[model samples]
Target: MTVAPHPALSANLATPTQAPAQRDDAPIELSTLRLPTPPVPPDTCVIDVAQLFLDANYAGLLSLPIVAADGAPVGMISRYELMRVFLQPYGRELFGRRPISVLMNHAPLVLSVETSIGDAARAIAQHIRSPITDDFVLVENGRYVGTALVLDVLRAVEGRLADRSTELERAYVRLKSSQAQLVQSEKMASLGQMVAGLVHEINTPLGYVRNNVEMTRGVLADASQLIVAQQAALDALLGGDVVADAQARLDEVETLRLRVDPAALDDTAALLDDTLHGVGQIGDLVINLKDFSRLDQAGAQKADLNHLVASALKIANHILRKRGIEVVHQPGELPPVECAPAQINQVLLNLLTNAAQAIEHERGRIVVATRAVEGRAMVLIQDNGKGIAAENQARIFDPFFTTKPVGEGTGMGLAISRQIIEQHGGAIRMTSSVGQGTRFVVVLPLRAVVREAA
Candidate 1:
């Protein structure tokens, strides 16, 4: 007949062990969490261990682990216990002759290197040994490796949880934003598709009309030369014609000449030239719009920063012109930066638009410059407009934080620009004085470094 086990022991035996709950996102493990091995005296060593404690004090160790032969952890000894033993009268004389293992916990908790932080934490919580303040010994395949404090494990796990939570929240926000953008894009695509066809229809005819206008201009030039020659001949033949038919023909020709006004012809040519220039500008604007809006053009390659800046400047030329903002471009010698060109162009254009908008004066000044120093490329955009107030400068790059009136700003320009620059291993900085001017500096690495969201 088997004797019945004690009630508590029976309960413990009946309870099926459940694995510790672990989040899928937890990044901490025993191997990474364990502190470096602390001072471990051989289990056979005498309790001159008090001296070991003194030595440990100098070395800044909190505790010591007693290891047996073959480097297997036998037990751990804490500084407090050792100090208590030595503080007693003649305690060293009585105990110093014995092996340090006498004072160490023979049944110390052990953890394997592959244990998850969650499992280790569970083990720590369930431990019922006396002097629970002792650090846990970390081992790999029964060989002593290191020690872990309960505090370190808890802190690491907590930090990991916080980071994972933050990441999920950010991802959720991005997902919602992306969904909205996709819906808006679909509508825009439908509109653009139909408009593109109309544009093609109009452009095809407009192109030929321009060609014909050019040809007409050439023909008119030739006609002007012929008319001049005819007038010279008419002057020579005046009052000298003998045949009545020839005289009448010459008179008719003279009448036609009188009807051709030189000034009017000049005006017509000027109008054609102006029309052609306007058509060209429209074509360019369409191209820039496509470049700005195309979401599928995210290919990275070696690109000239100055060329990207110029393209952006060209796109924003009209805004500058309207305000009479004078742009001073100093394209410094720079190396090619590996980046997605169109995205960088958009960032530059956004900065330029902000620069143009900041100015309240007719003689606004914008200085755009590029330079390479210390293996990094830099772009500087400075504007002398009603500058950004000092108080508002910090939040200028925050999304939806704008100084402009309600409909005039969505406040995402600088925010998006900074994001794009940072994605390419770069940074955007700003300096401004309320009445003087504002300057934006974009710094980018020549070589891109891959980064994960913090």
Candidate 2:
């Protein structure tokens, strides 16, 4: 029987063209790999179908699609299967006249034109066997489009993987850069807050010190004038000057002395004392700010936890005071623990800030306590405030997760705090109830284990 070529396939029997370059994120269309090979009807004689495979145009094709009268793909006939059938003795005579359907793959791999490259790869990987004997059929809307070599699909998939790997590397670098920026941004924000508070704390003493210095200057001037007048009067008396001139110098001295109150000297001394105290207060604040930041210090060192806590509190005192939040510090005797003091100070300040922010009311109380446990140090911060919701408590440490109104919080404080603690071979945990309160516990090893760069 004479077999007819599929009309649609015969119109486009040219060699396959290379697919156009696709974007990394774009889905690969199966039609890009489709080979417009003519399909044969199932009724075609096996020997006649075999002759079609011998055509130079079809030499590279591993399989030909078999379509039904209505254009639906029914199966595939591979070159391997055809060669296997004809190689045996008397195999040609026995099967040459039989219908090609008898040898066709009943359950061939069929993919849609819309299938993504990754999906297609997965489908082929699952069904493809060793020494691949058959190519897959590409269909659109359940109708035959053309054939696709399994090797082509594999190559497409491999190329896609390579592209994806490159894309992932680029994405990872961007992510790291963004993370670093966010961390620095948070640090700068904290620094700004500390500076504002320190300014306010320093101004109070600075204002008084300025006033006292001015007053002391005036009193000293009056006393100096009185002494000069008295010296003139004494010189006039010793040199036997005219009585009227001596009387005039003496009278001037009395007038200047009267201008300088008897208690003015003592008052000046008191003012100087107060000025020194104010200066000391400013100095302490400067010292505390420096200690809290520790920007000059690097690496790990043995540091007193109490000192760190005090520095953080002093830095955040203005914030707490403005909110009328009372702080109760309970410090226990602790050995100096080896740690990054700057990082620890940051963590402490974050906790203190969080505690203060959590309190929604004016009469809020926060208890900060520290103690040395067996081989470790522990710090506890407890606040009487509206607590975290039960469901949100789990994600409290997740980066960028915040309940604060947008623009008010970066949500990195707790997350960074936890990271710092954990990096020092420590742990941070929280306990909270919706309406009652919240508490955070931090545990640190006496000697931190240094971690290698990731």
Q: Considering every candidate listed, which one attains the maximal lDDT? A: 2
Write one digit per residue (lDDT tens) for candidate 1, span 1-454. Answer: 1222233223322433333455665545787755554335554444655566566332444566666546577787777777787789997777777777777777878898678887888898888345555768777788766667777778877877788789999999998688456434433533353245345544654776687677667657656765875775576577566566556666766775666666757666766776777677667766766765665656677889998888778667766776789999999999999887766876787788788889998789999999998999999999998888778878998867888787556676677678778988999999998878999999989986624321
lDDT tens digits, residues 42-84, model 2? 8788898898888775798888788886678888898899999
What's the alpha carbon RMSD for model 2?
4.2
Clashing pairs in 2: none
Mark the 10 consecutive residues where model 1 has the least summed lDDT: 1-10
**How many angstroms is residue 409 displaced in model 2 relative to the true structure, after the best TM-score fit?**
5.5
| Candidate 2: stretches off by over 4 Å | 1-8, 15-26, 38-61, 64-75, 82-102, 139-145, 168-190, 293-302, 322-326, 338-340, 357-365, 385-392, 395-412, 433-437, 449-454
Q: What's the distance in Å from true for residue 221, model 1?
A: 13
Query: By TM-score, who's the top model here?
Result: 2
Tell me the RMSD of model 1 versus the true structure: 13.3
Query: Residue 280: error of model 2 in Å?
Result: 1.8
